[model samples]
Target: MEYSESECHYRIKIILIGDVAVGKTSLLYRLTYGYDETIRPTTGYEYFNKFYLFGDEIAQVHFWDTAGQDKFKSIVTNYYRKASGAVMVFDITNRASFESLKDWYKELKKFGEEAVEVIILGNKC
Candidate 1:
């Protein structure tokens, strides 16, 4: 089969999940929106669009920022189930936050299985 040079395209959905004030929103903004330390946590879930060009095709990356609070646990957990990849964040300055990584890992595992790529981030470390 002869292929033309115009059919390549791909899209990726990534989610950022963690405890409150763990820098999940900060990291996403920093990387995606070019946000700095001044950026604040997303109250609930925020969406960001990222586009990349591959050869002559354009790939879109849809990023979902999930809340990092226990009160929103169920809602956040449900989001993780559909995540193709996840970024788990923790604040290095707080030992308690760092310690919560284990629980975050467990929860993420239950929702995002091995098929979902995980990136653990320790901010201020």
Candidate 2:
């Protein structure tokens, strides 16, 4: 978990995007802070940082959890500017959330770096 500056091989910025109440915040909470029964929607954005080892390389991962509300779309898209990767989350049981993935993908492609990697997450599955 500890790596000297020279030992670190990668620094990745990851952004999470999805429709409101789709468990984006909950997923981030579990990843960074462990399991919590209480789930709250993100207001604007929340960030978490951690280090991981990949074989002999060390990577610093930055996770940006953005608010999923329509009102916060602009703010969330702004954070996508320099993202190295993105996780587009959707609730498996919610048809609307799945429908919104196209919009999210458009925004991601527009604001994020051209080479940014993307993964689709079916949350609450």
Candidate 3:
């Protein structure tokens, strides 16, 4: 199946989840909208879009930034329902955050889309 030069379009839906203050939202912002020093906890969830131009093809990536607050855990699970990929974040400076990655991974596998690709990211910030 070959897509014509003008017919190629791609979209990827990725969810970012982790313990609070692990920089999930910060990473999303830096990747899609550039850096902002004031990092805040995502309330429930926020949507971010990043687009890449590949010759005639357009690739649009959708990033779902989920809150790290325990109160938002249930809400975050709901965001995982249709994700294509997931980025589990942790703070490298915080041991607890790193240890919690396993829990995040477990939740992703349990509630995220079957066969969803995931990568765990450790943030220094």
Best-fitting candidate, measured by lDDT? 2
TM-score to native of every candidate shown: 0.80, 0.92, 0.88
TM-score of 2: 0.92
Among all windows of ten consecutive residues in candidate 1, which has the lowest summed lDDT? 1-10
Instruction: Give a tens-digit lDDT track for model 1, residues 1-125.
Output: 22333443767788887789877777778777685767776777888767777777776677888887788877877777667788877888888887887888788888875789888888864
Clashing pairs in 1: none
- Show model 1 residue runs off by greater than 4 Å: 1-8, 36-38, 54-57
Error of 1 at 12 (Å): 1.0
- 2 or 3, greater by TM-score: 2
- For candidate 3, give the lDDT: 0.85
TM-score-best of 1 and 3: 3
Clash totals, every prediction: 0, 0, 0
lDDT of 2 by residue, 1-125 (tens): 46665777998899989999888888888887899988778899999887889888899888999999889988888999889999999999999999999999999998889999999999895
In model 2, the clashing pairs are: none
> Residue 100, candidate 1: how far off, in angstroms?
0.9
